[model samples]
Each structure stands twice: as C-alpha cells, then as structure tokens.
Target: MGITIFEDSYRHKGLRRKLIEELRRKGIRDERVLNAFDKVPRHLFMDSSFVEFAYQDKAFPIAAGQTISQPYTVAFMTELLNIKPLDKVFEVGTGSGYQTAILSELGAKVYTIERQKDLFQSCQHLLKMLGYNPLYFFGDGYLGKPSYAPYDKIIVTAGAPEIPKDLIAQLAIGGRMVIPIGTSDLQVMTTLDRISPTQVDIHEHGNFVFVPMLKGTNNR
Candidate 1:
C-alpha cells in the first residue's frame, strides 16, 4: 500500500530556492511561472531515492526512460505559452505529471498524453492522489487527441523531429505551442504562436536534450 507519498518539505525548500536562483540566472522572468515552480512539490514527482534532488534545477530519471523535465525548462515553457486561467492545455508527455501539476496549479485545464503504459498508470495514480484532475491518456502524441482538439496551449515534453503538424492543426486560432524539435543530440526549444488558421510564427529559444517522442500505445 504505497498510497501515500509525502514530500520532504524541509529538504525540498532549500532545493526549490536553488532552482529559483538558477532560473534568474537563466533569464526566466515570469513571476507566475516562478510561483508554479515553487508551489508544485516536484519531489512528489520523482522516485523516492531521487526526491532528495528533486528541486535541483536538473532533470531526474523517472520510469519508462523518461526524465521529469528540468524545473527551469518547465518555467521557461510555461512563460513562453503565456497561459491564462481559462486556457485549455494539452501536455504531450505526462511522465511523472510534475509539469501537469504545475499547469493545473496555474489554473489551466490539462489533458496529458503519456505513451508508456506503466508511466501512464504511475502518473495517473499520483495525479489523482494529488487531486489534480488532468485528463490522462495512453497514446501517440504525434496524433494530438482529436477529441480535445483546439487546445489553447500545447506543450511537448519530449523532443520531436519537427512540430507535429497535427498538433498545430489542433491549436485554437490564437493558441500557442512549445516544443523541442530536432534530434536529441541537438534540439531547439521553440514556441509556435498560431497567428491564424494558415499562419504561425516560430520563436527559437536555445536548446535541450530529451528522449525521442514515440508513436502509438495500447489505448486502442
């Protein structure tokens, strides 16, 4: 019955502070984004053995060969999306659901997709336990969930060869998407703002490394 996993607040607090300092050094300026970073108990999103390092501004390995996105990466992407309270968000990789938790905390209605069955099950349970009602799905992120198409904000936690055209098509007229495109060895973190049904502006903002985004799952 590993039903309850409480975060070590005292330890996380110090690391959380360190994470914030790193964000400042890295030019993450949104205060709301910073709050999301501090409030989301990231330690709750990692394996117990590594909870000790959860807020270190570094990615920690989670199940299914996934790493919880770095704290600064979360903050940076959230800031880039400029998500409002009423925005509907779609997360391409649920992983440990830490980013999903932050999105929910920021008042965005989240629908997250995780391909690995085990990771999906693990993240879904933890999210439910935390009282976050982010809709969880086991499927290929390459094909954005059509049932929830027209998302106001979409974020991909894994690296893609290119922004999935289907995902862009799913974005609302004025919606935005943040994704890491290119290869793991060299990926560019870019934000796509849908200017219209037929036009979008791409803003490139440095780079990151992540596991490759794969296709398909057993949700059939």
Candidate 2:
C-alpha cells in the first residue's frame, strides 16, 4: 500500500486556514485552544454526509445517536477545563471522539470513556487514523476512569443526575472538572474547582440540554 499524493497535496492547499479564521471570528480567544482546533480536522471525525458542516460551528450526529459537540461548545468546555501542557484529562463521554481529539491537540493526555460500544470502537479507529494519542475505553461515562485517577481536569459531555461522587473523588487536589448536571432534558453546565479535600468552587453556566448519562457500565 502506498500513500496518496493527492491527499498530501490537498492538505498543503487545505481548508484549515479558513477554518482557523472563522473560529477566531466566532470568539474562540485562547490561542492554544484555537491551535488545537485548527490542527485536528473536524471533517475527518465526521461522516462524509456531514463534512460540509464540519467547520460551521454546529453539532452533527455520528454513530450511536451521539453528536459531535458544536465547535463553540467544545471550545467553551475545553477552555473551562483550563488545560495545561502537563494536565492529564479524563473525558466522561467519548461521543464521536471529536472533543477528545481537540483535547489531545491542546497537549493533554486524554483518557476518555464511552458507553456505547459501537461509538467507542469507531472513535478509537478515527483517533488512531488521525494520529491522536488518547486512551479510549468502553464503559459507562458516569464513573469516570478511576484507573487513571486524580486527573487534572475532567469533562462530562452528557447531562447527569448529579455530579457523580465517583468523578469528583477522582479529581486531583486543586484540579477542576467541568460538568453538566440535572435531568436529561434539562441541565446546567458547571465548573467545579477543587481547592482542597473538602473545598470546591462551583460556577454554573445557566442552561443546556444533553442526553442522560447512564450508570451501570458493561465494563468488565
């Protein structure tokens, strides 16, 4: 098997510069976040049918009835995480692996868990194809990945009944987690900054709607 010359050629004369400029105009201010968004090709993570909308700042459905978060939402969440080069991030929902890919681009070592087996497998393949280094897993998104405990940042992509105690316990001292909490149809996006063993700060971003995060993982 040989590499495609046209693929390399198109990449050189690619769609990225325009994408970066558009994202900037949309107010994605963090240069590092922007660079990550710029580097990971969103179109590649999506189905061919939706590639045209890849850079349009909108969410699109992938396998397993999950969506690739809108670019703005993904950037907003990632920015809230306040990723540092040394941060080890635990992503609660793998979705289409778009957010995980973006986090990887921002230089975080990502450990993401997805409940849907098909979506998990698809995303794992996509990330590998894109040369992203993420530790993808199949399991409930609720518990978070305890094996990689004490993460610097944790982000939940779906709405949960409450902030899972399991995930909070897994947060490193002084680390932060950005999550969505409430019923499936209605929720609040919040950032929890842990100051100590018994101290945390909550900054809630009014409202949002997300799929319910189910418990009882099939992980063995």
Candidate 3:
C-alpha cells in the first residue's frame, strides 16, 4: 500500500462538529478526546461506500468482519484511560485504526496489533497517510506485545472472555488498562489500575457490545 489520497471537505467537518456535540451530551466530557475526534476524519478510516455515514454516532462494518467502533464508545474508553503526553500505550484489536489515531492525537506512543491481516495492512497505510505514526503489528492480539512491556496504558478494543494475564503483566506499575470483558453477546467495560506488582484494582463502568477478542491471526 503506497500513498493514498482523499478529501476532508467542509461538510465533513460540520458533521463532525455535530457529532462532537452529540458525544458531549452523552457524557463524553473529555475535551482532549473530543478534540482528537474532531481532528481525525472518520470517513477516511471507512470504506468509500460508507463515507456518507462516517460522522454518524454509530458503528459500521469494516474489513475482516470487524466494525469501526461507535464514536461515543471510543470517547468513553479514551476518557477512562486518562492519557497523558508520551504515555506508552499498547492497543489490542486495531480495527480500522480510528482509535489508534485518537491515541496518537492525544500524544501517546501507540503500539497496536491486529489479528486480521487485511485490516492490519489497510489501517497501517491509512494512519500513515494521515500522519499518525503508531507502531503497527500484524499478529495475535491475545498475546499482547510483550517486547514493549511496561506500557503506561493499554486498551483492548475487542471484548475478552476474561482479563488477559499477559496484558496485565505488561502494564507499568501504576499504569491503567481499559478493556471490555464478558460473553460474545455483550461485555462490561472494565478498567484495571495496577497499584503494585501483585495488587491491582478492577472497576466496571458499563455495558457495551464489541467484536469478540479472538486468538491467533487470520490471513483472510
């Protein structure tokens, strides 16, 4: 995938502004998250066919049976992470790279992994085109990126059956992780605050439905 071209027209900006307002009303009070949302053109992360629906506060299908997460969900999760400048972030399930772009915009060094080879390649190209430089990996997300251990923050975009011990182990002391855990039908948005080497605090926010966190990579 070489350089690609696309236009972010004034109309798109206007719709995104309206989306920002919608997110604010729905309890997404983080201004930095809102600003990141305002900057990244969601349409560019979507297929050309779904471009018109890009700014809507809704989830839409992307490649490899994954869906670009709803804007509200993304904002909610980001707000929970409490990102700071230069915080090392490891992201599981880099679907479409929209959330990855958000993390980058918020000044985090993002390391993202995708199980689907197609999404991994396409998102890598698109984020690069948009000038976001997160390190990208095409592999199993369940294993987490251990080489980049001691991450200041970690976010899992997919719903896990339970908390992944590997990811928890990679977090830096006093680091935070936002993940959704439950069955395939639904999940509870959970956050883990690593207090010490053996002690961690777990908290649940609310319920959300996400694509299941799967093991291994899919060539398709």
Question: How many steric overlaps does candidate 2 have?
Answer: 0
Q: Write the per-residue lDDT of candidate 1 for residues 1-220, one digit (tens) a residue.
A: 5645764466677778788878989899988888888777788888889866776778888887678878888888888889899689999988889989989988999999988888888887777777889888888989989898889999998889998999999999889999999986778999999999899999999978888888787442
Per-residue lDDT of model 3, residues 1-220, tens digit only:
3333468889999999999999999999989999999999999998889988999999999988899999999999999999999999999999999999999999999999999988888888788888999999989887898888989999999999999999999999999999999999999999999999999999999999999999989998
Number of the top lDDT candidate:
3
TM-score head-to-head 1 vs 3, winner? 3
For model 2 the TM-score comes to 0.89
Q: For model 2, where is the 10-residue window of minimal lDDT?
A: 1-10
For this target, which candidate reaches the highest TM-score against the unseen true structure? 3
TM-score of each: 0.93, 0.89, 0.97
Determine which window of 10 residues in candidate 1 has minimal summed lDDT: 1-10
lDDT of 2 by residue, 1-220 (tens): 3333113235432566666777778677889988887677777778878766667767788877778877778887888888998689999888888899888888899999988877877777668877887988888777777888989999999888888888889999999999988987898989998899998888997687777788765432
Which sequence of candidate numbers ranks them by lDDT, best first? 3, 1, 2
Candidate 1 versus truth, CA RMSD in Å, comes to: 1.9
TM-score of 3: 0.97
| Off by more than 4 A, model 2 | 1-16, 218-220
